[model samples]
Every structure is written in structure tokens, then in C-alpha cells.
Target: MNAPALRLALADDQALVRSGIRALLAGFPQLEVILEAGDGDELLAALAGTSVDVVLSDIRMPGLDGFGLVRALRARGDATPVVLLTTFDEDDLPLRAAEAGAQGFLLKDASPEDLYEAITRVAAGDTLLAPVPTDPVRARYAYRDTSAPTDTFSERQVAILRLLAGGYSNKEIARAVHLSEGTVKNYVSEILDKLGTRDRTRAVLKAITLRII
Candidate 1:
């Protein structure tokens, strides 16, 4: 038998954008948008009664933005996977969203395939950070580029860094990469040192600025 469609809730202040997304998802038979809200608070309230497999939300909603929403849900022990959407101008918000317990992050203008992939992966208990367009990110923080190292990350480091951007903890990263937690911690420290950042958020931002992830 076929699997049931993945039920989804969407939160965005703009009705048109929500409608457009709803329309786009309508084309995917395996996905369903069961609820729509104008902001995080509204979505949270609706979620109190409605069950959904995933949430696709705008990062800059009017009330209780995506980061706040993720924190609130985590505080309430709601583990429902959430994908926070951002526009090109707001490229830095993805790291914050991930740190706040969001399971996925994607550009608002992401292709339908990317959105679909994020929702599916997050729904399946995996974290994801979609490929960000480097041009806008580079343009936003061009000043920092000169300081960024010319050295490239190994394939393994890049994978771990992507998970870091998805907000995975050391333990989670270890499990994902089949390494010990201590090893993951070491890798994280190395990544921070290479990026010259003191924390995961800054490391991720620097990676984006340098077009490394």
C-alpha cells in the first residue's frame, strides 16, 4: 500500500505567498497542507488541536517569528519538524532558526524540489539545510570575504558543517556521521577554528559568507 500523504501546516504573514506555496504543494500527491496561519502564534494555537507531520513557516512573520516558534515548540516538548523559510536578503536567519530547534531551513525562493526535499527529510527525523545561493550571501558580507581562508573543507568536514548549519547537536552529528560524540565535538572545534568563529552560529555564517556550505 502507498504511504499516507504528509500533512503540513504553513505559517506566513502574506496571504499571497501562502496561497502560492499551497498551490505548489497541491501538485505533490504525497504532501498536504492542512492548516494555514498568518504568524507563529496563530500557527502554535492551531497546532494545539491539529496534528501535522511538518511545518513550513516564514522566518520573519509578524508575531512570534520562526526562531521564537521553534523555541516555543521545543519548550512545550513538541518535536514536530519545522522548516523555516528565508529570503535571500535574510540568509543569516537560517542558522538562528536551526539553533532554535528547527529541523530544516530553506530559501523562500527555493525551487519546489528543494522545498519538497526539506519537508520530507525533516519529517523523517532528519535535519536539512538547503543549498543557499552564494551570490546573495557573498554580496551581503563581501567585507568578510577577504578574511575568509582560501583553504577548502574536506568532504567529511563539509558534510558535518552542513549538519551544523541544520542545528544538529554534537551527539546528533555523531550519530549522523557514525562517529563518537567526542569526535564530533573535535570536528566542531576544528570547524570553528578554521572559520575563526567562537560558536556554531558564527561558524555557519562565515561558511555562508565564504561560500563554503
Candidate 2:
């Protein structure tokens, strides 16, 4: 069977890195290079009128940054999946991206095979991938000392979190649960707070570790 066709965008501050990724991804007959962006703002601008299937971006860009771009996309209710390439695994970038509604995360030094596979999975709506760390990304909730949660989340929040862990978007979850987007957002906020995580994705991961999800 033919590989599924994908209209993809790329964002990286380094022209060299962008070129390298473009070259690697070129081997995938199903993936077309729709556009290249040097920064997050540029990426958003490119997305304004373009119909894209996926975005592979560097986490740290000159303007706006990858996290901000993902957040903006969520704010606009766009579901074009995003995949971030990061140099630091210990920076909380991946977890933050997920909280902001990204599709997946990959390390900058990942093998071409891994990169290709990640794109395929992201397009398929999966988020539970092995943490591909380049330099030990930081945990949103440091489990260094076996600390426990001080507050428990309600059943609704727990349900929201389980779906989040499964990589479903807030809008999707809202529609599934018959709740307004605002209410879902509030539940996410409370979940993060109760889980002692700075972002929802981190909270989800932490919840998994503690068997809370």
C-alpha cells in the first residue's frame, strides 16, 4: 500500500538544521515539504492560509517559540498536529508542548527512522511514545523524594486527565463529555494545580507514575 500523503511544515532557527530535516523527510514519498519557517511567528504566519497535515518544529526559535506557537494553535481551535524537535530533554519542553496541545515530541538528534515514525504516529492520533530524551528533560512534578499529592481531583477531572493522557484534545474531550470548552479548561487547570504540575501533560505523566490515571 502507498504511504499516506502528508502536507507538512517545518520550523527551525538554524538554516542548516532545517535543510537537514527537509532532506531526511524528502525520502518519505508520502510527505511533502509545504513550507519552512525560521521562527514560531513565521510558522504561525505560514499556517494562516496553508492547509497542512503536520508541523515539525524546533522547540527553541527566535520569536514566539514552539510552545507559544502550539498554544496559539489551540487557542484558534486548529487541530493540525505539531511535532517538536528539542535539544534539551530536561527542559520540560515536550510536556509543555503537550499541555499546549502538540501532537508529539522528538529529539533533534533522533534517527531519521524515529522522526518518520513519530510523524506517522502523530497523524494517527497517538501520544504514548517512549520519552526520547536528548539531555534529560525536567519533570513538571519532581518525583525525586516520593512525595504524594496533597489534594485529590474530582471524577470529572480524572476523566478529563485520562483522555488527555491518551492524547485527545480539550475540544474533543469537551464534545465527548458534553461540557463547554471553558469548563474543560477549568478542570485542566485544577488538575494541574492538584497534581503539582505546571502543565496538563506533565500532570498526566505524573498521574500515570502514581497510578492516578
Prediction 1 TM-score vs. true? 0.67
115-177 per-residue lDDT for model 2 (tens digits): 887787677665522233221222444344345776976656765775676566778767655
> How many clashes show up per model?
0, 5
lDDT of 1 by residue, 1-213 (tens): 999999999999999999999998998999999999999999999999988999998888787988888899899999999998877545445556656878777887767866887788789776664444346555664435337653666656866788776667788677656789999899888888887777888787778777676
Structural similarity to truth (TM-score) of each candidate:
0.67, 0.61
Off by over 4 Å in 1: 89-91, 130-159, 163-182, 185-213
Candidate 1: C-alpha lDDT: 0.79
Best by lDDT: 1
Candidate 2 clash figure, as a count: 5
RMSD of each: 7.7, 9.0
